[model samples]
Target: MKTPVIHLDVDRLIQRIALFALAGLLTIGLSVLGFHHWQMSDPYVRAVLEIEGDVSHGRAIFQMNCAGCHGDSGDGLVGPSLHSISAHKTRASLIRQVIGGQTPPMPQFQPSPETMADLLEYLETL
Candidate 1:
C-alpha cells in the first residue's frame, strides 16, 4: 500500500494575503483622501438658515426630486435653470416653490423645512 503526500504552498498563500491587505489599505486611504469622488458635499454640511440641515442629505433629495426636471447641475431641463436662482429669486421664493409647487408639470414637494433649507444650501453651491 502507498500513501500520497499533500504539500501546502505557504509562500504563495502569504503573498496572496499580503496583496489583499495592501488592496484594503489602498482602498481605505483613497476613501479618506476622497479619491472616491462624486460626493455632493464635504464642507461639514454648510447650512445658511436659522434652522439646520445636512448638505449630503439635501444633495440626495435634490437628485431624487429636482434633478429629473431641473437638471443635475441646475443647467435646466423641463424646469428653469437653477444655477443662479439665488441671485434671481429670493430664498423664501425658492422655499415656496419647493413646498407649495409651481405651475402645470411642476408637482409640489412635501419635504420638511429642514430638507428645504438644505436643498437651498445645495442650490447656492451651484
Candidate 2:
C-alpha cells in the first residue's frame, strides 16, 4: 500500500499573505479618505465652522424653536437634556443630528449656517 502525500507551496503562501495585507491597508486608507471628504463636502458644515457664533442669539433661537421639547434651559423635557452634550458629541456630529432627525419624534431642523453656528455655541455652554 502507498501513503498519500500533500505538498505546500511556501512562496505562494507568503505571496497570498502579503496580498491580503496590502488589500486591508488599502481599504482602511480609502475609508479614512472618504470620511474626511464627506465631512468637508457639506457646504453648511464648512460655512458654520468658518463663522463665529453668538450665544445670546443662539439662546433666543433655542427658546423659540427648541424650548417646547428641550426645555427653556435645555434641561430636558420631551427631548433629552443637552447638558454636557458637547462633551459627548462633536460639533459636526451635532450639526448632523439636528439636520438628519434620524431619531423618532425629533423633527429635522435646517437652520442657516450662521444660525447653526450660533446654536452650536449655545449647546457648548449647556
Candidate 3:
C-alpha cells in the first residue's frame, strides 16, 4: 500500500497572510484617526486637550494637602496609597470623593473644578 502525499500552495497562503496583514493595518490606522477626530470634536475631551495639566502645581497642592496622610510619594501613611488609585478608580470618582470629603479621619477640602482636575491629573501620575 502507498501513502497519499498532500501538496500545499505556498503562494496562496502568502497572499492570504498579506491580505490579513493589510486589513489589520488599515483597521488600526482608521481607529487611531477616528479617535483623534473624536478628541478634537468632543467638547469635554477638547477642554482637557486644550488645557495641559500642570504637574508642578499639582505636586505643590498634593504636598500641601495630601502628603500628611497619603505620604510624600502617596505610599500610604495614614491614608491609602494614592500611587495606584487611578488604576482602581476613575478620574471622576476620585474628584468627587475628594470634593465630597467622605473619607473618614481625613479633613474635607473644597477645591475648585480646575484644582480638582489638577489634583486628579497629579494622582494619575502617581
Judged by lDDT, which candidate is best?
A: 2
The TM-score values for the models, in the order shown, are: 0.57, 0.72, 0.58
lDDT by residue for model 1 (1-126), tens: 889888989999999999999999999998866732422242222233455657787888889999999898889899888887888766655665676676658897866567877787787777
Give every collision pair in model 1: none
By summed lDDT, the worst window of 10 consecutive residues in model 1 runs over: 38-47
How would you encode candidate 3's per-residue C-alpha lDDT over 91-111 as one tens digit per residue? 545655676678787778766
- Looking at candidate 3, the ten consecutive residues that score lowest on lDDT are 42-51
Model 3, residue 59: distance off in Å is 0.7
**Per-model CA lDDT versus the true structure:** 0.72, 0.91, 0.76
Top TM-score hit: 2
Candidate 3 has an lDDT of 0.76
The TM-score that candidate 3 achieves is 0.58
Question: In model 2, what are the clashing residue pairs, if there are any?
Answer: none
User: What value does the lDDT take at residue 114 in candidate 1?
Assistant: 73
Task: Name the better of 1 and 2 by TM-score.
Answer: 2
Stretches > 4 Å off in candidate 1: 1-49
Ranking by lDDT: 2, 3, 1
- RMSD of candidate 1 to true structure, Å: 13.3
For TM-score, candidate 1 versus 3, the one ahead is 3
